[model samples]
Target: MTNAPLILVVEDDVQISRVLQTSLEGAGYRVAWAATLGAAIGEARSRQPDLVLLDLGLPDGDGLSLIPQLREFSVAPIVVLSARGREEDKIRALDLGADDFVAKPFSIGEVQARIRAGLRRQRQATYAEPIFRFGNLRVDLEGRSLRRNDEEIHLTPTEFKLLLTLIEHRGKAMTQRFLLNAVWGPQSLDQAQYLRVYMAQLRRKIEADPARPRYLKTETGVGYRFVPED
Candidate 1:
């Protein structure tokens, strides 16, 4: 009936698909399944399911290639099913507007938990205006402004996005590739320099000492993270 939520499952692995379908059905969901991006898009567009279970490895297309395209129609929470499982991949998916992800060979319990989290997020549209504070620096997203010890600061669009991305996952390391892809595009996956430039610019504006940034710290070969002072 209409009381049950519909879930669109996209996976190329037949057994995985079957297992997820069975588990999801067992958990009381109306299920729709697809094995490729084309079919996934068609079903997602037409069905407008309450949520999406998207597989990264499709025989017909790359899952990353389909995300932006899918965003055109469905605002349903997309939980990426990927084998990459790297921290970078997780950050990238999250930054690209995915609600969550489950790596390959995952436990059904974990997937169900993530699904619950994502759906919970989707339902809670009204959030308390978060005022992020790290030492002397503060950002009020609802107010759309930054402050340092009561002094307001200006931020460009790109700078704001970069700052927002870092702040969203404070203390978590995010790769240059992930940042570049999220803000720039998939074409920027190879352009680490862009990330370096933006990080430097952000530090200059937000940090007390850009040369020795405390909040926006880099992880040598990996990426950057925003660390809030306790």
Candidate 2:
């Protein structure tokens, strides 16, 4: 299906690449595989994949290098697949702008879920939708207003700014530093506690259950991610 989203799979291992290709195709996506960093960059540039499934370990070089390269031309989400489960590794990838990370020995279902979320976010970004809705919660980006279950909810200017920042980078796992800089400015980089306070305030107004937020999720040891549902 030419209309299907193209997913570039950058993995050297034949087995993993084959599996991902098969599963992604079966999930209604156009799949392209590149076994090395060089080929991956070429494919990304030429085909302009809707999303990228990248392996951290490549034959030519570390896959981490490809993140900025691909970012230069495309906004396609990059989901890293690696055996390195260390917190540092994940922090590095997310900091580098990798959309999401999957530890090796991952299930097809999990990967597909990540892909779906990434693509959904990508679509939102592409269209620049004026309004965002998740369940009964509705955000009017143009109007700068939010509503829950037909009732208009109020958010302070700071809270609204923070929420807007998260919505702009909807699907990607945003590091605390990134959010801080985007919403508060570079000077507030060290004030992580500001995020914690505002996030809690936001959850109270947007989430049906602030205790178990469905949209604003915490990526422990990293930061937060806003998962906007359909």
Candidate 3:
């Protein structure tokens, strides 16, 4: 229903957006770009691209602020591209309505993979509708958001991907190694502490009951699982 599977690349930096445009087009995707939040919103309203590559630093407003608004109007997946290196920064963006994200200075391969994942999710959403719910937690796959007790819950980039991978896999128990590799990368597989920190953080937000989680079940010496309470 979109025009050429169009993708919107929104970055205040002209060079970055241009480079992304070229890269995406070269890979056979049509792209529209905007250098400001206002312009980006306009592009979304008029063009309605299939996917969006958003940068955290926009000229008019915080890129995160625009996400919930955009989600209200479109089903297009938004993949955030940010240079912010802090764990909190990534979490904040994900908690907004972004579907996926990569820290800036990201490689082309990563971006490509991210785009593929987003499109794949878009397609999957069309056919099989899966809503993750456990206690007060709920994930709207199509809308790319989370709600706690009917109220929205915000997550960051790392947190969002972490949660998605676990919930997507559901009962299929994964390991710390698998979680690290899937969300962080192969190189971070050895950084086991990262998993601990993130898992703890996710519990605080998703657990009604962070003290003892019911849905995000952990497999000590292994990984975690998302088994919705029956």
Q: Count clashing residue pairs per candidate.
A: 0, 0, 7
Candidate 3: worst-modelled 10 consecutive residues by lDDT? 221-230
Give the TM-scores of the predictions, in the order they appear: 0.58, 0.94, 0.58
Assess candidate 2 and give its lDDT: 0.91
Candidate 2 residue-wise lDDT, 134-170, digit = tens: 8788889989999987899999999999999999888
Model 1 C-alpha lDDT per residue in residues 103-198, reported as the tens digit of each score? 788999988876775665455433434786778877897776899988888898888888887766554446677778778889988888888898
Q: List the residue pairs that clash in candidate 3.
A: 90-156, 90-157, 91-155, 91-156, 92-156, 95-154, 95-155
What is the lDDT of every predicted structure here?
0.79, 0.91, 0.78
Leading candidate by TM-score:
2
Give one digit per residue, the lDDT tens place, for model 3 in 141-210.
6676889776888888799898888766554345666789889999997899999999999889877778
RMSD in angstroms between candidate 1 and the native structure over all alpha carbons: 6.4
User: What TM-score should be assigned to candidate 1?
Assistant: 0.58
Error of 1 at 158 (Å): 15
In model 3, the Cα lDDT at residue 149 comes to: 77
lDDT of 3 at 12: 84
Candidate 1: deviation at residue 102, Å? 1.5
* Superior by lDDT: candidate 1 or candidate 2: 2
